[model samples]
Target: MELSQAEIEDLLSRAAKGQIVRTDFLDPAAASFTRDLLRNYPEVNYKVDGGYPSAERVRFAFFPIYVFPEDVELNIGFIEITGNFKFQTVTHRDFLGAIVGTGIKRDKVGDLILIPNGCQVVVDRDLVPYLIQQLDKVHRVSVKVKEIVREELLLPEAKTREIVAFVKSLRLDSVGASGFGISRSQMVKEIEGQKVRVNWKLQVKPSYEVAPGDVISLRGRGRVEVVEIAGVSKSGRNKVILRRYL
Candidate 1:
């Protein structure tokens, strides 16, 4: 991820002045970048907050060494969208499209978890009222949007498909194409076009090596996790086990 000069500098300036600094929702790349960059300033302390475990989007709260990390407020909110499913069912794209249509920037929103009979939406707390009033329908389906506590969140089980494949090298393109079930040529195009991400950071290099536990995701497609790398096969190809999120 390309680090923005103003973004990091502004946060650092606040911390240097002993002022509590909080950022808006940040993508995984920005979060990772800030998490690493702040380490240079040992006087400042920070907390990575995404409202839930394994959240991709998160905010960082920076304060002085004297301040309690838990005292910093992330101001995250959880909202649920439920609708009559017999007539029409909604998808992630549909939910996102409807939310984006409400004139809210994508950065203000976070992850949308799919659940039975509805979906759980994590977002900036200040935007809750606006969203609840403005967002009422997705495509042709009528939805009910309401605020919910963290414990009330009905988390759904993640779906995955395992792939066991062999390749000469564990290059991004080779593993990505195999996991995404696409051709190497097509994967290259997507990578160069900035449609691919490794661990939620933009990765344009197809030759980038991927180790076990690295996540490879393609825009419009689900994510893939490199689960294992056993010894090379008899044919000399590298053996791999990948779990592709469905």
Candidate 2:
């Protein structure tokens, strides 16, 4: 629901249990809607999420809004999403990027970004109908209500080098294939063409198995799967290390 800062504050104050998820996205009418909600309802458990778009995923890439009852746990969920709306983190960099991409110039004030991951929302079940009504008039945001499950960490105790090295050892063509959906050859070409770097240094080899303490940087695919070679290979053809980007 759109809400003014004052109205939001008032609503929050009146809520016996309250939560708000801010995004970097903004609608001119959002603040006013928020104010209206506060004026009408003293207790509002509003859960909002938002984020920027990524080439990696399409659905939750747009500015998205969602709500669940306040009893739900706020945990980071990692799932392949498919829908009309996408999400990303709301940061100064994200805001400027949106402005540049959309060619929409507006000031950033109390704007929040709803990352596709790393965020959640909670609201009272009874308030959903009213929330949906307010969202109908708010532009640039599409709201969906879903049961979310948080992502389970694979190696919580593993270090960066361990992660990268483990991925490299996956015997995939490239780090992209292992961590991302891209192929190994594609990753190699990007690096060999001076598009890839290890610890920020130009790297051209796709088969260059990552080790612990190495930071592999790809131009378009993003950086990953290189760390210091923390351990040696048993057959001498493989090694183990942690990835800087897990």
Candidate 3:
């Protein structure tokens, strides 16, 4: 859902009043918007965590401008859904559809890790019970759900393909198009359509310079990280190393 400036101000106002306001699961675009909004209100502190390592989408919690206790944990829960792995393998989209079908907002859900035998989903704590009760099927396959401890959560292993390419410039579009094997015009089109993200924030400008260590995500194309700038090529082009998530 699109949030207006007034709604953002109201959320900040509540946080300033010492109220702990937690938001639903926010996609990269919404999360970036919230981050930009929070920049104007330093008095209202907040945190964004997706409950696992390397989570792209996340939930935001607004806290008063005060030192937090050491024991304060993020309000995240894991739901382990197991099904007949031999008969049907549940994919990330399948689990996501089942969760969303239960009337849960997209922002309330986090990463969905597909395991060999089942899948694990990170979600807001408030919706744990509801998800467990409602997430009984994934597509046409029957599934079982139960809450698991944070330690029990299984994270997906990263599988990336290293790409070494030379581009005219280190701009997002230049490196992304060359690394992903797309035309420059196609990359620009994707950027203009708001289907490209740099470091998890929506970046519309194709000319935005991308630095080493920056991760670029294109909708429908997976993600790619600029690993390093090896050096300048003989022709004065940039020699860059990229790791594309597979």
Name the top lDDT candidate: 1
Local accuracy of candidate 2 as per-residue lDDT tens digits, 139-236 = 23333434333232121242332343334353324543544446667665565677766544555666665544444566665556543444545555
lDDT of 1 at 197: 92
**Tens-digit lDDT track of model 3 for 1-246:** 645557767888898888877776676667777888898888888777887757767877787878483334568888888888787656788888888898987767888888877888888888889878888888778889999987887776789899999989998889999778899999999999999989778899999999987889999999999999999988999999999998
- Counted clashes in each candidate structure: 0, 50, 3
Model 2 poorest 10 in a row by lDDT: 55-64
lDDT of every predicted structure (CA atoms): 0.86, 0.39, 0.83
Q: Per-candidate TM vs. native?
A: 0.76, 0.29, 0.82
Ranking by lDDT: 1, 3, 2
- Tell me which residue pairs clash in candidate 3: 24-107, 25-107, 25-108
Q: What lDDT score goes with residue 124 in model 3?
A: 84
TM-score for candidate 2:
0.29
Candidate 2 structure lDDT: 0.39
